[model samples]
Target: MAVEYHGFRVTVDAKADATDTQWLCRAVLEGVEAQSETAKLPCIELAIPKLKIDVLMALSMVEQTAKQAIDEWWHARQPEMA
Candidate 1:
């Protein structure tokens, strides 16, 4: 699952096909950092990690936060359309 927050899109690879954990972690870190940077939320990368448990928690938090942020952002832009 994935979620976009503040502009950052958080995604998970629950069953990565990487041959090694190191490679998987490296890919995940780079992917998240890239997403964060492209979203103009540089510091958001600091919230992501390679650890499984940490990733799960962060994913959940980001999902919830993203929902709220999107609701607020869009609501402010088009209150009548909401």
Candidate 2:
């Protein structure tokens, strides 16, 4: 699943682990221009450290984690106030 957040695109990939006992998730973030909707930077991949037995719960965690990652990324690029 993919969603737009903070002028960027976040794509989430979730699947069961090798033993099929737990779910693992990762998110790919790409910079996108608002006007043209084109990529502006290389993709950033983040591994979400959340394990769950249910797929729905895992997906929710991944989405929330991705959003927080995007927020931190955006804040790091901004100039700090004196």
Clashing pairs in 2: none
TM-score of each: 0.36, 0.68
**Which predicted model would earn the best lDDT?**
2
What digit string (tens of lDDT, one per residue) describes model 1 on residues 16-53? Answer: 23442321211121123442454321112224434444
Superposed Cα deviation of residue 54, candidate 1 (Å)? 3.9
Q: Tens-digit lDDT track for model 2 on 8-63?
A: 78787787667766666777777786632553443443333334246666767777
Q: lDDT at 82 for candidate 1?
A: 82
| Model 2 misplacement above 4 A | 34-53, 79-82
Overall local distance difference test of candidate 2? 0.65
Clashes (N, CA, C under 3 Å) per candidate:
0, 0
Candidate 2 C-alpha error for residue 73, in Å: 1.4
